[model samples]
Target: MVDYKTWMKELDDNTKLTQLAIPGTHNSAACHTALPSVQCQGESVTEQLKHGVRFFDIRVGKQFLKEGDDAKDLQVIHGKFPVKIPFPRLLKDVLKEFYDFIKDNKSETVLVSIKQEGTDDWNNDKDEFGNCIWDRYVDKQKDLWYLKSDLPKLGDARGKLVLFRRFGVKDDEKKQKFGFDAASWKYNTTEDDRGRFVVQDFCEIQNKDDISKKVKYVKDLAEKAQKSNDDKLFVNFTSGSNFFDHDCWPQQVADAMDKGGVEKVFAKGCGIIVLDYIEAHNWKLAKALIDKNF
Candidate 1:
């Protein structure tokens, strides 16, 4: 069997990072939740990596252990639904899986896009512990991450967790921050060098009719990226669900796209296609996205 993790080693060192085809999971760790609107994937983080998913969308929030407790820890969340495991546990699990995969196959890298979720005031520079989230999690684990803002060559990021910062940074003028600024790239935005990336976030699915429209919108954005001459990265989201109405689920959206001939739209290439319920259909959708690289 082909090792999808090491496939990037075949590409040239000068290849633009945006030009490569990458498979990603939207709300990657929400599989364990029972809520219909919150669950996005059926596979765990380790399983997704084993099945060729290189990019992960992770949301973290502050969680207090008890009432009036000054101490709090980060927890993974999907909208309002919180995962059973803490953020530190999730990070440890992912790192264990990632290091094991790359120890044997050293050509692959993981990109984690982290955003703040829930109602906590994450915008503050530091928490009650007098330490910023970056200092508590990212800065201490520097050896395991690729802490650079600019896109680098494949050779530079091998066996590393490339940070994609989707949250605000501290305002300290003396300290230098790392990771790609995902907030600068707005939702459903056009591609440009200044933005560094483009994203399609049509997440509202009200009815069965909305599924077809969402799929088409995703395909159109992907096609636009393929035709563009610029090198800005494109992140296409094929996941959508209604929270209040529950009219649609992420798995249903993914199935609709697969059945509606979505694979044919990526003949040229797909930058980074993020899907929900990636383990469904025997991982057929994920394989189709990875096949575009060849």
Candidate 2:
């Protein structure tokens, strides 16, 4: 197997993106666990940063309000505030998996999905306003993942190295009309401490059916949650291909259906919502979760 540095260097050179340390701020607390770092060829590495796994340090550039301020009085917190920065934690976990997977095998090939692009539609103020009127409308992922790195360009396997985006939308007028972009964006600035952006609520669009329906569902849910004074909502979309679906996992049937369609359906509900982690060929039922939740 390639050394950790060699693997990282190969990724950097082939991917054309710089490695960055996950940043932090003064107000943010650190993880108690000393996450395992990557090591290869006598060189120890701190992260296994591929192109799709987005990383964000919630402590950098955080914002705060004085006590008793207009924004401070709102207290029915559910999805707002107490933002969840799952990237660093997820990164640590993925790296461990990567390390363990190739423990016995020398130079095992694995897939890495890095953030490629995202929309600049939501900023701090827009996020707050959207939260006021919408349920759990958090955009931290956009900044953390999308605005952080370049995703793998080709889905084809290279030297046992397999990587792809598990969640991505097609670039079409219909998809764009919903205000979700097909491209991922990387950040252009440095770090801060208090929290660059406070996340109210976040969800993945795991649902994989009808696009229009998903849009309507998400908007309606956001509206309903606002009326009920709810804090967060979860949304997700699914991409139906995996290693097995490809040459990596030949036994697996990797196919692409209307994943955007799936996300479109779940996007319609209100309140604190959670769509179960879905699997391939289950888009029909995943879409039905909208009916289950509604």
Candidate 3:
């Protein structure tokens, strides 16, 4: 096995983060969520990490333990569907898995893309539990993470959680607060040369016909990244699901992308490739992305 998780150790410490072809999982912890549109991953977080996935997209929300109960805890949510792991459990169980993996593989680092979701107002400083989710989850765990906003070399970020904040920062005083903002990139909008990275969010795939179009768009962006002189990170998404069609899952889109032309783009070397149902098809797609780095 290639052991893609710690592959960065083989590269020079000065290697630009943007230049590495990282394999990521979209909705990383939602494998247990039963919802069609929400359950993007098929493997647990531990499995994903062991298989060489370094980037994780995690969505969280506050959920009441009981109806009308004042007590609430953070839960992994994808839209209306809540995954099996609660916030505390995720930290104690799911995230701990990553920490252990990194501890053993000192040269490896993990990038987490966390966003607040569900009915609760994430903008509020505190949830009903009177505990600040940001403080407890992110701020307190400073030692385990690499919160710097700027891109860093592989050696600097090794054995830490490199945060990619999808939710807005709460405190103004914490301007240079850890991690990079996902909002830094254009969302579901036209592509343009801006910031230190290039990202395309074509996640809205309503019908089977939309699959080819989205795949082509991602391919074009990857090709552009390969030829560009800007040295910007390219985050391409090969995941989507439609509420109307349960069969149109993220795995299907990923499979389509694999067959359509993603292999060729990857062969020339590419940037971060975020995928869903990474364990499906015996992890063929994820392995393909990792192989590009070799």
Candidate 3, run of 10 with poorest lDDT: 122-131
lDDT of 2 by residue, 157-192 (tens): 222223222224333332322221222222211111
Prediction 2 global C-alpha lDDT: 0.24
**Model 3, position 84: C-alpha lDDT score:** 64
Better lDDT candidate (1, 2): 1
> Among these predicted structures, which one has the highest lDDT?
3
lDDT for 211 in candidate 1 is 84
Clashing pairs for model 1 are: none
Q: Would you estimate the TM-scores of all the predictions?
A: 0.87, 0.21, 0.88
**lDDT of all predictions:** 0.71, 0.24, 0.72
Candidate 3 residues lying further than 4 Å off, grouped into runs, are 65-72, 85-92, 124-131, 184-187, 190-194, 267-269
Residue pairs in collision within model 3: 147-178, 147-179
Q: Rank the candidates by lDDT, best first.
A: 3, 1, 2
Against the true structure, whose TM-score is highest? Answer: 3
Give the higher-TM-score candidate: 1 or 3.
Answer: 3
Q: Report how far residue 231 has shifted in candidate 2, in Å.
A: 44
